[model samples]
Target: MPPVLVKGALHFMLVYARDGHVEILKYDLRCSCLSLVDVPLVGPGIHGAAILMAMEDRSLGFAHVDGLTLHIWSREMDFNRVASWSHRTIIDLRNLLPIQNTDERLRLIGSVEGSDTVFVTTDLGIYEINVKSQRWKEIWKSEKFRALIPYMSFYNPQ
Candidate 1:
């Protein structure tokens, strides 16, 4: 669950979760390849949720959470390069959180390295989602679910 850096020429990308069905692996530091990336299948019961992001034109991006509905995928390249998986955005976290239902369960808890900003966990807390500006807040307040490790930095004291 650790290997997702892909910017240009693919230096890292590895996410393999079965039962929820997902498999993506790409690492090619100038021909030292390690392929297998054609991910686009998650419908039948959507098991382990999903996460793998690095988009902003750098291609390769997929984030899936089916319940409160958040499914965004993008990995496109044609003209012979051949690489597909395009179904871009569909977020409906009850129209962006403040959800007051019950039965708790909504976990994505990853992303925000180079930024697409995603970290969601709701027993009623921990939410900082931007996934292309659908904006969000409430950055911490747990009760049950836990697994969040996303760090961002920018400081200048002059």
Candidate 2:
């Protein structure tokens, strides 16, 4: 179970499982815990809290909601939230692979090893997002990548 500590007093916990299982379990947070008007929610992930989207000045902040889109706070103090609002860009969440590449996506993960970026994989290829620019680009595009170097360690035989 992962938890998000908000405003100090409130605790938001996210529970997850496979598609068939209920993710949230006995959470300290309930729909009533909020201010009624959806302020901004920062979701919890496997290890830490993840913003379906986030904005930062120097430190990191996260916000995310399942079923709804991910919202990030942006740096432009005038922009207000962690994610930008003036631009209002909507990213299609469908067809995106999970953030966890520890499983079969290990090979896909290796490509972005050195850089401080996040990769979103699809049948199309691997797209790396620049943390600063929030821009996404394709770094690799073959199924063959799934068979390369780190992807081929015989010890962890798939």
- TM-score of each candidate? 0.31, 0.29
Give the alpha carbon lDDT tens digit for every residue of 40-154 in model 1.
Answer: 7645454446777776677778787877888878888889987788898898998788866645568786777666777778777778888788889987787354456666677
Q: Give the TM-score of candidate 2.
A: 0.29
Candidate 2: stretches off by over 4 Å:
1-56, 63-70, 74-116, 142-158
lDDT of 2 at 1: 19
- Model 2, range 1-158, lDDT digits (tens) per residue? 12323322232233344432122222225453442112233223322223222223331233322332233332233444543223223344343333332233222232122222444444556666545555677767743442222122236556
Q: Indicate which candidate wins on lDDT.
A: 1
Error of 1 at 66 (Å): 15
